[model samples]
Target chain A: MKVTDEILNRFIDGELNSEELKEFKDELNNSRDVQTQLRALQAASVSFKNIKEDSPAVDFTSKLMLSLHKKFKSRRRDSIFIASVASIFVVISLLIIVYILAQIISAAGPNSSFQPGLQVADIFEKIAQTFVSKFSSSSVSIVGTIISFGVIVSGYFYFDFLKSTRSN
Target chain B: MIKLTDSEIIESIKRGNQSDYSILVDRYKNKAYSLLKRMLKNNMEAEEVLQDSFLKAFQALSNFKGEAKFSTWFYRIVYNTALTRLSTKKRKIEMEMSSIDDYEFLKSGFDIHSNEKEDTAKMVNELINRLPEKNAAVVSMFYLDEMSCEEISNVMNLNVTNIKVLLYRSRNILRDMIVQNNLVEELR
Candidate 1:
């Protein structure tokens, strides 16, 4: 039976069965070619084994750590900024709701005591009138455009922050 | 200080000891860099990819279930990062090479043209670097990392049988080169 390089590879890898091992050993005892092949394979294996690991740049770890630190700091700032913005939005929303409710209550009951110098309802009417009378369609459209741009920029930063946090 | 296990260091990093990650980095950087150097065949690109790999691993550390060894998981990042860089450079790495044609091509194509006598180790190293990217990665993972074929299969996303085939074919090619160049005596 011919002992091929495949068989020798299996032998080196300890993939040979007991029967195959016995047969291979028998062949090994008789054949110089098999011995030569085995030696060559072993030498090749040794050469690989002798390979030294290549180091990265000397500052690799420090540079990575510095970047990580920067990411952490930036994420912290983003978190704080998002939290502040959200808090302001919630507070403003609640104040507006309370102002509207107070206006409704005052309008419904003449005896209601909550009264600001400028009534919220009148302010809303005046603002609506101003938009309708003084603001041109193009001006209103410009305002809408500005609002849309603001929303888009905020959304972009929010998603970008989320991505940064998740990746970090 | 006692050397912390990779798992222990990872735990510390998870606990907010971000600096502790440097321990794992120091432990793996050289070996993983070696793997990248072989796969990318350019030291600068390899180093850049290695840094990116470490960043990716750190980012994904929370998802590490520790089901596999850390080295296996980390090397997968290293391998994939180098692969992406290679793709970006439009360098196609052959994943599957026909055994007979690959063996014959490697055997005939390996020519060490330098007339100056070279060390066997350096000669063998150059031969290894000349291997196809994926094949070189397998050899590096197997010998440099001392990883088993199973672990290599995990990192390379190939079946264990395929990994063995790559390993065997690579070794045979290296064996032929060694024998042809009369380097076995030096190894002996």
Candidate 2:
């Protein structure tokens, strides 16, 4: 039998069927070349399996954990930074959108022919008049209430931050 | 400490329990390290590659679809990391090995018996490392980890036929090396 290397490889890997395996075994028994090749393959496999000293360092996991911890922290910081930037951009965009809408409504309201070349002083005077007229008694009370609410919210967050920092 | 399956551990990690990832690190460290060590043949490089692969695996966990076993996927990363490092160092083997006939391996004068497995095994550390990285990887994955050809194919990103061919080539090369060194008799 003109055995090929591929066939021998398959034989060693047990990829051959019973008949082929039996035939190969008979040939192996008869052939010193087959025996030598098989021994070489077997030795390589056995050596790797018997290589008990190829294990990792005992502190390997600990070291990996440390690196992983730093990675996780770095990832978290990046996420937080991205989120914060996105939130700031969203807030700024919303403010710009609201301001643009307000300007459109204001320009469209009383001054039907509001021109672009209006003086800065005239623009400020118009804005001041509008604010003063809009700030009636009920509006003033509403503003007071909003200011009080803002103070309480800020105070709550400030105290919370102080408490957390102190505990730390 | 209770044992959890890889999927379960992954689920826990997904639930914001990052510390649970240490379990995976602990589980795969040795095998990953050994494979890297065998491939790179450097302790510091092996350790660096091991750590890098683990970090990469953890970061890419969300991309893992569980189509393959976690070990295969993770080992693939380890293998790739080692490959990249070797390539960067320009020490990667570029073999133009010709067709090795079956009879070529069969003409060996060395008569190594399987009973001398220990003697043969002793020569493997030095002998196996001399193999080209690709064949060395295939051999280690096949014999050391007992990975199936399909799994090795998945990890190595090669088809099953190619992996089989690598295996054939690796076995022949190792056998040839043994004959050249006359270690077959020494190991006898």
Candidate 3:
């Protein structure tokens, strides 16, 4: 049987089955041409292996470790940065909601000077008076304030929950 | 007392144990460098690619689920990094040489000689390096690293059959090159 290039390739790549392997080995032993082909392929593979393995750079492990350290540190720093930014955003959003609620509450309280006897001083006074009057007369503002506060607190808690879950 | 696994080392690094990454890098550095050196055919570029590969691996360590062996994942990174660098360099050279005439002129100056092989082993390297980069990669991965065709398929993003065919063809190419160059006699 002739050893085609395909068979020789399969033999070289170790893709041969038991039967094929036996045949290949028999051929290699019996035929000088097959033996020559196998030897050349094996030698070429060995040379490539040696060139790669014998690179001159010394302390490659240490250098790689140094670069890995820098990379890990930078990645960690980036994660921390992103986490801090997200936390700041949450904090800022909470603060803004809280501040808006505080202003609404101060304007809506019973002692709000926007009652019938109170003076409407200027545009600021008129705006404040209008805001107080709306809140005092209607239950909608109170409900809205409660829901908004609930939403803000829930958002904060939810963000914290998400952060903890992600960390885990 | 504990012998840390590669995944464990990666987890430690992800959890901010920067020092533990040294073990991971130390474990894979030489192999990665060797892969890059064979792929790029230049020491400086190979070293740079090796560093970049390790750095990329460290950065993406969190995503590594250990589905494959750590070395396989590391080798994939090294292979990609080296290929990317080579392509970029090739593109830059092409850009610098505008016309076909310019490219031919540049190519004439570039001496792509097979190194003098002192022995069978050296002749093998010469032939492997003389192969096209893709074929060389397949040959190296199959022969030098001893990776399974399936694993190489995953690493190279080719079908298993494709990798098998590539390995087959690449070995034949090397065999032919060696015979043509009269290196088989040298091997004997």
| Candidate 3: tens digits of C-alpha lDDT, residues A13-111 | 577899988877888889987877778877655555455454536777677666555555556766886798799999999986676555655665786
In candidate 2, position B58 carries an lDDT of: 85
Q: CA lDDT, every prediction? A: 0.83, 0.74, 0.67
Model 1 DockQ class:
medium
DockQ comparison, 2 vs 3, better candidate: 2
- Which portions of model 2 miss their true places by more than 4 Å? A36-40, A86-93, A100-168, B93-122, B177-188
lDDT of residue A6 for candidate 1: 86
True-structure lDDT of candidate 2: 0.74
- Cα lDDT tens digits, model 3, B36-122, are 666677778878777778778777888899898988888888877777887787843543344322222222222223544454455
Give the per-residue lDDT digits (tens) of candidate 2, residues B74-154. 999999999999888877743213223333432344344543545455456655555566776877788777899999999
Error of 1 at A4 (Å): 1.9
Number of the top lDDT candidate = 1
Q: Report chain B TM per candidate.
A: 0.89, 0.79, 0.76
Top DockQ model: 1
Better of 1 and 3 by DockQ: 1
**What is the lDDT, from 0 to 100, of the residue A135 in candidate 3?**
70
